[model samples]
Target chain A: MRRVSLLAMVVVAAPVFAGAVADLPSGRFAPLYGLDVGQTSFPVRAFRLDVRPVSRADFAAFLSEVPRWRQGAVPPALADARYLATFAASKNPAAPVTEVSYFAARAYCSWRHGRLPTTLEWEYAAAADETRRDASQDGDFVQRILDWYGQPAREGDLDGPGSPRNVYGVEALHGLVWEWTEDFNALFVTGDNRQDGDISKRFLCGAGATGSARREDYAAFMRYAMRSSLEARSVLPRLGFRCAYDDVGRSP
Target chain B: MRQLAFALCLVSLSAAAQGEPRSVLALETRWRTESGEQVSLSARKGRWYALSFVYTSCAGTCPLTTQKLKRLDATLAKAGKPLDVVVVSLDPEHDTPEAVKAYRARHQLTSAKRWSILVGEQEQLRTLTMLLDFKYSKNPESGVIMHDNAVFLVSPSGEVKATMSSLDGPLDEFVAAVPAPTKGS
Candidate 1:
């Protein structure tokens, strides 16, 4: 068996009796990247995602098991210089661990017998509000998320700064830290901004043909842009990740 | 003196043959070629090759990328440089063996002797892509798959050697970098 010793620094996490997993029901919703021509809706099945981003303590526990992933021990191909930079400075175990590369994040999730959520799963879950499952159309909801996007990243000890909880009992989906989705690199934009005519046709596949369904939704567009800019090995100061499990065959 | 010289030659030849990283050679995932022939990465041993991931239905970078690889292969062949091209499907769900064959025919890439367009199970694809650090995802709503557009060079020992974002990128440099196959490797 492969062991990865993740060092969990001393920030404490609140105990969720349910092991910190929130079960989301199946539903259909319009994603930021809209449906193909003649398609009406996107169906998302039931699954469990971490209620919060993986925190310092959680990652520390991971490091204690998987030593290969520790700072300096990890290969440059797997993570860049900034991987786990946050854990090095402060011992805020409860704060969300940031500065992790997609490879490192994926390894963490796989170790737990889970995987990173798909782009659609993340988008579908993030679309919810405190009460409503789909609050994307509400102007106030959209504005608040946009405001969070514009604000500068908060520095140090980000354990639990109390972002709004969605109806599914998930926390800090936004307004805390940017996240690593399994398919982050799938959002393709050309390296150069030489857009002539029919940008979608020139660059992307089916969904790219139609562009974004909600072109007015700047917040969604911003998310897409951010996702597009990342590479698998890129480690940023504000980026972190959580894990998700398949609903089938796994007892949640 | 003759025996000692032969022994020394054998040691050097074995070292040259084992030059690739052990991790890459250990990969045993199976993939079905556009011609419906099942193969594995290890089957590509004994030959230098370049690989890229794309789907047949893609109206985006896939076509141009195919053309570029075709050109690279042609140029190498004309120069009498031996190289193989392997294109794996990112949209394996839609790019069945038949679909891959159609794609090959459409692009005139039917030379199984030179080019191989392949598809495999999702888990197999995942294993290969992860090894190469290739990222891809299917748009759930649209059924469109998007992926990183990059080519990887694999040495004759089946180890990944170099990567390029586009097919037209630094071909000469890559050609110079590729390790020649050891005899009987």
Candidate 2:
């Protein structure tokens, strides 16, 4: 019985060490942006993604290990004036961390031997509902996402229930917070996005509903527009991140 | 430079640990030069320089940027405030040493000793570009890289002093931003 108990302990311990990742299958992804004039779907390779957004507790542990990332110690180039502002608000171990800049989030992932997901990978994993993969076509799933987007910002639901686990076993992709991607700033917006919107050739796609590959995927376009507007160092109260791993069998 | 001023969008950056302006020198990523040697930018510290991104095979815009840079170099030299030009390759997968040599010959840049062309891994390229707000993305299918045409004037400490568009923006303001050469070198 003691030997059996020891074997069970090892079984539970292995996944915890791996930080709970899910292996998403390879697919042809059609992101809302980045496709050129005739470019169709992007061939997305299979990759591992964190099961949930990086939690406040996870980041706190990282900060403890690497003090340079502590609230006041981070360099100005790596984070903004409000970087990690929510670290102290809630110590809930499972809540998504917020207010981390792209650079800082990238660093945390690097320290863990992983990196932030590409925009395509993130969107691909997020397209699923609880029961089915590729549910972006489902009107109910689309409306539910829009409804979450329309809701008022939660003050600080450190321990609130996350988005239910999807078919891929990933959780809290939505109804949680916006995330940092590996190349969030690669977007080319029409007009001077940094300035007043005007006529400019740099406008990547067209504009409004017309700019998107799938007009029905308005929620994805909103996410793209929001991503385009951000600077690498701009950290917001709702912006957090998760890490994606390259090696599937190896623990992160 | 109306377009340039709009594109740069240089935001307020607080001083670094050295109490200096936010500097790109803090990045530790090393790059491979035209000689195929990997090196850090630290060797070029303590001297103001101009940096831009390009690909040897880029048929559009990059050539324009290079010509503008050559013109800018001559203008600075004539003004006695000459600065080195650091050009990073956008496509390392194809910008091999031979391609770099061909590029130098095609652009007539072989005699342009002040210019340094460097290339490295895509990850490093992305990191450096992000820090400088030098946007670029390579199309996987066509191997075409769509990038911004901005050129940055960096300080001795690696902080960006000013920027200008190489495609159409004027150059007088960018030239004036470079500090005059210190007395007696």
Which numbered prediction scores highest in lDDT against the true structure?
A: 2
Model 1: per-residue lDDT, tens digit, A70-187? 8878765556666776566654556777878777888789888888987778888888889988887788887787777655456552655645879988888877787888775454
The clash count for each model shown is 17, 1
In the range B108-152, model 1's lDDT, one tens digit per residue, is: 866647787778888677767755656666767566766666777
lDDT score, candidate 2: 0.74
Scoring each candidate complex against the real one, what DockQ results?
0.10, 0.21
Q: Candidate 2 chain B, which ten residues in sequence have the lowest lDDT sum?
A: B9-18
Model 2 RMSD vs true structure: 7.5
The per-model lDDT (C-alpha) reads 0.68, 0.74
lDDT of 2 by residue, A80-119 (tens): 7888765665535567778888888998999888899999
The TM-scores, one per candidate, come to: 0.74, 0.86
> Which model scores highest in TM-score?
2
TM-score for chain B of all predictions: 0.79, 0.86
